[model samples]
Target: MFGIHDLALFVVSGLLLNLMPGPDSLLIMTRSATQGWRAGSAATLGIASGTFVHILGAALGLSAVLAASATAFTVVKLVGAAYILYMAIGLLRSKAQDGVQAPLALAPLPYRKIYAQGFLTNVLNPKVALFFLAFVPQFIDANAPHKALAFIILGCIFNINGTLWCHALALFTGAASRRVKLHPAASLWLKRTTGGLFIWLGVKLALAKQN
Candidate 1:
């Protein structure tokens, strides 16, 4: 259903977005570094699950509604921004206790909670929904047969590419975190940087226009 140009564009776009240090990537790194590979991988799975919801929305035309309705877009954006700010506050508070020499291990959070957190983090971001709405359409050939199927195929490709890339990042960061487990100062700085990134992205997302 996809042409060579379409596949190339999807891969290039996905890679660029994956490389961008957004809230999702920052969250994955923070969780991995703090909790280890298991937690990081779990969070990565959660993020992937969330992307599926976006894909579903795109498929069902809900994303088009979100693109059209300012009120709906604003509501989702506010929720996402608030959530990121909350995460930032938690990280900042942890920084205050940086003197403690606690080993970095994944706290025993419920699996469902971890999964839901990851899912909601991405699902609630209006920008992501709108992006897919605008982005996927560009690759679709209006004159082609089975256009809907074409979009769905491309969406799955994007999701798979994104999941693999992010998972690799989580694994690598988790390994690095193991080596630096004893360095509380370094961990503290990493957490602070992560928290800052989330807050900054949240603010930028909140301020984004509907265009």
Candidate 2:
């Protein structure tokens, strides 16, 4: 069990980390801007689901393998980067549609695919796995019975906090859907911009060194 002081510190640190802009936030915003509220929310859920995997990996000490091995890190990083780059290319290649339809209705919304993208984006990123390995153990009681369980509990708390923050972000970014719908050109530009961001993120990930 965590002491009040440790719990408070964990909450504060988690909030700070969640608020700091990162690849996950970028992804959520991209989906919100390009797709709509539903898609954004789906992405959030997908991200949350992925976080659970990292949490479990951390609890089981599996993430340490990724953290310690340069080859493992590089392989995961490149795969994640490749996936995101593929998404970017698909977005760039998409034909512009002319319509005043609701932004969510711009195309057939594939909720499952969006969710899969979110899940894969997080799970494939060795950085995220490494982060959980590093971040969650600090507050764990060294002498606690069931250290793994303690880690899992703390990770669950972090995931819950992060999920809520992401949901709020999705709603805020999704608000732009109305404007996107009002201008067809806006949709094209938004997709292009999102695609560009993904490309940059992909390159950055690919070139990242294990820390």
Return the lDDT, model 2, position 62: 35
Candidate 1 lDDT for residue 133: 60
lDDT of 2 by residue, 125-156 (tens): 98787766555544543334455677688889
TM per prediction: 0.61, 0.61
Model 1: per-residue Cα lDDT over 142-175, one tens digit each: 3334444665677788888888877887788788
Question: Candidate 1: lDDT over CA atoms?
Answer: 0.64
State the displacement of the C-alpha of residue 37, model 1, in Å, after optimal TM-score superposition. Answer: 1.0
Task: Evaluate model 1: give its TM-score.
Answer: 0.61
How high is the CA lDDT of each candidate model? 0.64, 0.67
Q: Which stretches of candidate 1 lie over 4 Å from their true place?
A: 2-5, 62-108, 178-211
